[model samples]
Target: MRTFDTDALECLAAIVEEGGFERAAVRLSVTQSAVSQRLRALEAQVGTVLLVRSRPVKPTSAGRLLIKHAMQMRLLRADLETDLQDLTPGAGALREEDRISIAINADSIATWALPALGPLVSEGLPLEIITDDQDFTHEWLREGQVLGCVTTLKQALRGCKVMPLGAMHYVAVASPAYAAENCPKGLTTHNFRQIPFIAFNRKDDLQTEFVSRACGLRRVALIQRFVPSVEGQVRAVLSGWGASVLPTLQVQSRLDSGELVNLAPDVTLPVNLYWHCWNLDSVVIDRLTAALTTAATQALKVPG
Candidate 1:
């Protein structure tokens, strides 16, 4: 039987996670030279290069497999820790390497996901959250950078399980002042193109999709300003930067207070979200799934 060094494997993971050898050294409490040496030894043992040395270093395909293995081993350790704590209560604490990492969409994180995770965080679950657009979060899980993710993808990855968590309803909204000045007739076929729209990022298509659906057009385009955050987009809209498609749950207070107006009160865009996790018998995974699903059920609209 062939054996690989566990420390070396963890060094590779830390380097990739932290983005560089110096940062990885700081994370692992080792010297920078030591970090490099460990990585070299690991590559030699594996008989291939693992990482692409770039700014915010990226893993090669082989490195991804190794990273996934390392992360899975960490999950196993976390599971064992949970078992031990149940037996003795207030037992040994989890190390930094045992931190649970997951990817979630920025909108969900701003609205319901953080609150759902509060109990676990307060109880000492070392958690790392990677936020991205809902459509792209699945890539994090596919790359083995996260143990689980809340994403728009419905199909489960190989060796993964997926559960539908309903859908987030989005409404096109703008500041009352902006709406009155720019879109007095609300979002119509003629006015949508004239009114600027705030998009989360270049990757976001919700704004365009909403406009097309609302205007009964095959294709539509609007002037876009990127804000990159759910809360930031809301702030920009309130500042009269542009109109945006925002979560109804996130902007309900503003709407009620008349700070913002729904551009299409009768129309809403429903984005279906799902929870994906590895098909492993880990108590922590089960707990996370339960927490996310329960909160999503209450917070998100059931998709028709």
Candidate 2:
């Protein structure tokens, strides 16, 4: 049986999380030289190159395995802290490195994820959220960059648990004036190519997918404008920049107010989401899973 140094494991996590040796040192309250030494020592013990020396440090395959182990240990430690606090209130305080990090799609973060995590944060949970597209968020967890994630992937990764979180319904919408000017017939195939579509980012294919399905085409191309955030996309639509496929929950108020109109009332997209986390016996993970599932049940559309 082999035992590894906990300090070295945390140093590696800091380097990857903070993005560089200098930042990792700052995070760990150690000198850069010491940080490097710890990493080298750990590498010596593991007998391989653990990190790539890049602008933003990236972990090797072995390094990812180690980082996942470190995150699991941190979760167990947090659970232990909770137990100790119950026995003697205010006994242990977690350090900066002990923050619980997770990945969520940008749309969810803007809509319901933050509110679900708010109570825990208010009680000093030290939560960090990393946002990406729902289709790709699973990569964060697979790479061990985050302990948990809400993503569109249904299958559980090895050594992880998954739960369905319902689906987010999307509708094609635009400002009333824009719709009248660009899509008078309500987003027919003929007009879809003429009107610009507001995409969340280059990775976003929702607009293209929705338009293609609505038009009954194998594929269709549309003029596109990019807005990286959900709120930014909504604002761009409100400003009459372009048509967008937005969440019904996000645009319901604007639609009700007649500021935006659904371009395709009958065509809707429901993106199913799932919560994936390490299958660990930790109170923190349990609490997070509960909060997210409960909130999703109320906020997202039930899948039939």
Candidate 3:
């Protein structure tokens, strides 16, 4: 069994965060040579090179594993300290909360997840939010890139626990002018041929998937605008650039105000969402989960 040195692991994490040994030394309040020696010690213990020495340091595969382990351990340690402080009636002062990273889909982050996480953010628990496709968020867990994530995958990673958040419903929408020029009446194979679509990115398959099912063909329309951000994609569609699929919750006001028309009245796509987090005992993680569940229950569709 490989025994990890706490100080050495902290040094490696700092180097990865600060991007170089010299910068890491500044952050850790140590000499540059000390940082180098600590990293060398960790590498010797692990029997592999953990970091790639470059302009901006990047972690090797082995390094990512250790970094993730160190992060989890650090959070647990913080939790322990908080608990100990709570036991004392009059603690010296307030404690600083530990930061955690969460990976989620762009639509989720834009629509509901961020709002659900807002209260915790206000409480001073900083979160590193990373946007990824729902289908691929689970891979982040396996790679140890995030502590938790909102994913569409039902299965949990070995050391993770999965909780069902709810379903996000999507509707095909377009600006009135775009619909009048293109899909004036309804979604059909013939009318959609020449119409353009605003996709979130190359990874965005919602528009194409809706088109395939609605048109009875697995082919996307010819014209395309790949706006990478959620707000940008909404703007692209709103500006009459193209029609696209958007979360119904996100466009309710616009749809009601006649800014956007529902191209397909009966057409809706439902994506079930789940929360996957590290299976560890921590008060902050538990509190976050409870808040997310409460918010999701109010905004999303619960399973029967």
Candidate 4:
């Protein structure tokens, strides 16, 4: 097996992380040509192509392996620096941003996640947040893209610690006028099938799932509208495009104002969320976990 030098491996990892040779060069304070040469040398040493040379470059499987090692090395270096600092009297303690990266879903980020993260930000901790869909957030943890996440998955990934974040409450809602016109009686399993639905996107199935659970049916009205963002989804529902399942936090004001009516007051979907993070001993991760736990307790209702 050919031996890979530490510097070359680190360089390749930087290129992959930064997503381009030029950016990696800027990060490492080296010339673009120098970054290119190091990548070429590393690829030659490995006897395979490590990166796809395209706009916003992507890593090959071999490159991913090296990137993981590079991240581990970086963490180790950071720990060493912390140890050295500890030996000096009157040295300032390490800040949060210097220690962690987190991945979360957009709904959580927009609603409950930020409130939980306030303590960390107030303390000047360095945090990088990647917001995506709830269903797919765990993929970032699996790929080592983030050290922690708020995900819907219950199972813990290998080498990670998993804890329950809390359940998000959702209710089927429609504008008061629309509800009065279309729903003379309160919503039940039988009437839900006939109601036109507003979906966040083609990928969203919250309405469908609610209908399925409520009525034990699969077919919904073919006439559906798509609104992609959380705010847009709420607006579309409020505008009477169709009824949708919205988080209570997002639609609480409208509900209070009688602008939107709950389709079924008793019917709700509680999506249980989990926190997954690398199972490592780090003060930053611990602090984040504590903050999220406190926030979840206050914001999310316990599943019944």
Error of 3 at 296 (Å): 1.0
TM-score of 4: 0.80
Write candidate 2's Cα lDDT for 1-304 as tens digits. Answer: 6778999999999999999999999889999999999999999999999999988989999999899888887888888877887799888766668888899999999898899999988766878899999999999999987889999999999889999999999999999899888888898967888899999999899998899888899888889999999999999999999899989989999899999999999989899999999888889999999999999999997765
The window of 10 residues in a row where model 2 has the poorest summed lDDT is 90-99
Backbone clashes (count) for model 1: 0
Candidate 4's C-alpha runs over 4 A off are: 1-31, 54-56, 73-99, 184-196, 218-224
lDDT per residue as tens, model 3, 1-304: 6679878887887787678999889877889999999999889888899999788988899999998887786677756655765797345322322347678899888888888889877755656787888888888777776778888899888898989999998888899988888777877877776778788877778888887877778677556778878788779888988888889988989999999999988888888999888898988678778878888899999754
**Candidate 4 local distance difference test against the native:** 0.77
What TM-score does structure 2 among the candidates reach?
Answer: 0.97
lDDT of 1 by residue, 31-132 (tens): 999999999998998899999999999999999998988889889888898889889999887887777999999999999999899998887788999999
lDDT of 4 at 119: 76
Q: Comparing candidate 3 with candidate 4, which one achieves the higher TM-score?
A: 3
Estimate, for each residue in 190-257, the C-alpha lDDT of model 4 and write its tens digit.
56656788877776777777766665566655346877778888888778787888888778888899
What's the alpha carbon RMSD for model 3? Answer: 3.0
